[model samples]
Target: MTDNRTDPDPVADERTTLAGFLDYHRETLALKCEGLTDEQLRLRAVPPSGMSLLGLVRHLTEVERGWFGRRVGGRDLPPLYFSEPDNPDGDFDDLDSTDVATVFATWRAACAESRDIVAASSLDATAQRRDGTDASVRWIMLHMLEEYARHNGHADFLRERIDGATGE
Candidate 1:
């Protein structure tokens, strides 16, 4: 596949560097899912594990909404795919009736919203999380980077298993 991802700028400032890397990881996830059919995207390639490319997209949508929208932006939004106590794994589990187009659209929207939130706020700005603890925008960005990096690793393996294709 053609990799359209731009490498993070080496001489950029702290904020720019973090955002660039986070975006790079985001693009990595998308690249992993590129050219796959709907059934392939939803295929649980790894045995005994319910993880799939579509599930990763759905889960990251919730994560972006939670960190950028709910926690950082101070929006009282509900979960996108899963509930708190019940069906927490719904993002990964409830894919039988999911519309692939809608899920991708929602994920892109969340990423855009997150970019807006980051652009409007300072890295030092803090917000209260669900546990009444405060997190700075810098911390949130780092956390998001970590989250995406971890999941993207999974995406790499999943994609390879699906089609024997692999890359950084």
Candidate 2:
């Protein structure tokens, strides 16, 4: 298969570099999952982990919402996949009952909204956490970049296990 990932430029400014790296990792996650059947996407190829490509997408959706929607925008939003008191691991654990299209749509929407939020705010812009702690947009972006990188690593393994497909 053809490689589709866009490399982040090394000479870019801080903001451009951060955004490019985040986008690169995001695309890597999607590329790792491309062309797989729904059943394949949901298969827990790596035993004892309970992680699927679909679950990764769902979890990232919630992560995007938590950081960008609720924390950064201060919008009153309900939990996307799981609640605090019940089924907190719904994103990864409850994949069998999920509609693949809906999960993908939710993830896409969350990512778009996150990009919009970041675009409209200054890097130094601050937001409040649930615990009343402060977080800057820069920090949120960096945290999200880290989150995507870590999960994309999981996606790499899962994809490779699901099929022989590999590489960025």
After TM-score superposition, the amount by which residue 4's alpha carbon in candidate 1 deviates from its true location, in angstroms, is: 0.6
Off by over 4 Å in 1: none
Please give the lDDT score at residue 44 for candidate 2: 86
* Alpha-carbon TM-score of each model against the true structure: 0.97, 0.93
Candidate 2 C-alpha lDDT tens digits along 73-124: 7788788788877888888887777899888888888888888888888899
Deviation (Å) of 151 in candidate 1: 0.2
Tell me the lDDT of candidate 2: 0.86
What does candidate 1's lDDT look like per residue over 67-122, in tens digits? Answer: 99988898887997988798989999889889998999999999999999999999
The top-ranked prediction according to TM-score is 1
Give the alpha-carbon lDDT of every model: 0.93, 0.86
